[model samples]
Target: MRANEGRESAIRAYTRYETLTGHVWRCACRARMLESEQRTGLVVYVDVSNRLQPPLPSGYFGNAAIGVTATSCAGDVVSKPVGYAASIVRRAIDMVTDEYVWSYIEHLKNQEDLSKFQDVVACGNPNIAVASWMRLPMYGIDFGWGKEVFAGPGSMSIDGDSVILSSSTGDGSLIVAICLEAIHMDSFKKHFYGGII
Candidate 1:
């Protein structure tokens, strides 16, 4: 497949994985919650900069991105097929307009406690955050010597967070770095790669 084709496939797969994982986490939370308590929904945060039209300036160095979240109940997400989850993700992403971006900035500006603006995972919520670094020129960076053989995130111990990075071979492939507790890693692995092969 061409690079774009591979990239699209990777995006779809990653989104599906994220949706499934978010559902799993939500279900886990429900299991732990009191019987009278309401089930906390799952929120999946997807990076929305690439979906923006008339993209930001090429050399713009500031944070030019916002996250769009797809939320659903544990039963709805875990019981439904992957296509259902994918559609939720697609709609959430499609809702990120230029106006929405500006509104998000205003919302941030209005916040009284910046410290409370924790990421989905850090907020003690049943949520997941996914960031893609697939198109970055990881292998093309050469200070003085030749290109580096391998490139990936500096650390990978953040639970409920996943980062998608380009393969080091410069091939049209991706490497998804996921961090989960030891007990849940096996089940996550099963759901992550079960039908993909």
Candidate 2:
């Protein structure tokens, strides 16, 4: 879309995740009618599948993602152009590296039991977690029958959990799926589309 809009030359060439995450966070904040100064956050999962120096072997497969949080006041999220939030998201992401990943693992090791660990991301009302699977092998997943026609998370079981998936046709379109209270969906939809610039 940015290419079509001829905006690649813009100072900030936003990635798809940054674009959608910022837009969604703003719309969600407005939909919830959060107070102007209330702190709002977005937790985005970053894949470290290949961040290590030696890297995991080519066939390795497991949970290799970590979440990074970006925060700002609700007023900033709602009042600024999407690029403002995108910059925050980009900064958070840019901080991650092989060194950070190693340190994060050591931090995780300190937890007595991994099952009870929570990473300080506020879960329900004001924070959102976005997991992008756009670059994963979602469409190529096949079984005995055939390649699946569509592949996506069965549901967003919690409030503010979102997923970004590539369209099955791989036409460069994306599927953004998020869950919010029924009462807020209408307002959020309006803001999400209307604020597109």
lDDT string, candidate 1, 1-197, tens digits: 11122234645443534444443443343333313333333344444455456666677675555666666665555555655555666677668777787788799899998787674344233555566676667787887878776678888776556666777776676677766556666666565555343
True-vs-predicted CA distance for residue 48, candidate 2, Å: 1.3
- Encode model 2's per-residue lDDT on 99-166: one tens digit a residue: 99999999888888887666454556798888888887877666877978668898676888888888
Q: What is the C-alpha RMSD of each candidate to the true structure, in Å?
A: 6.4, 3.0
Model 2 lDDT at residue 96: 83
Q: What C-alpha lDDT do the candidate models reach, one value each? A: 0.56, 0.82
* Clashing residue pairs for model 1: none
Give me the candidate number with maximum TM-score: 2
Taking all chains together, each candidate's TM-score versus the true structure is: 0.68, 0.86
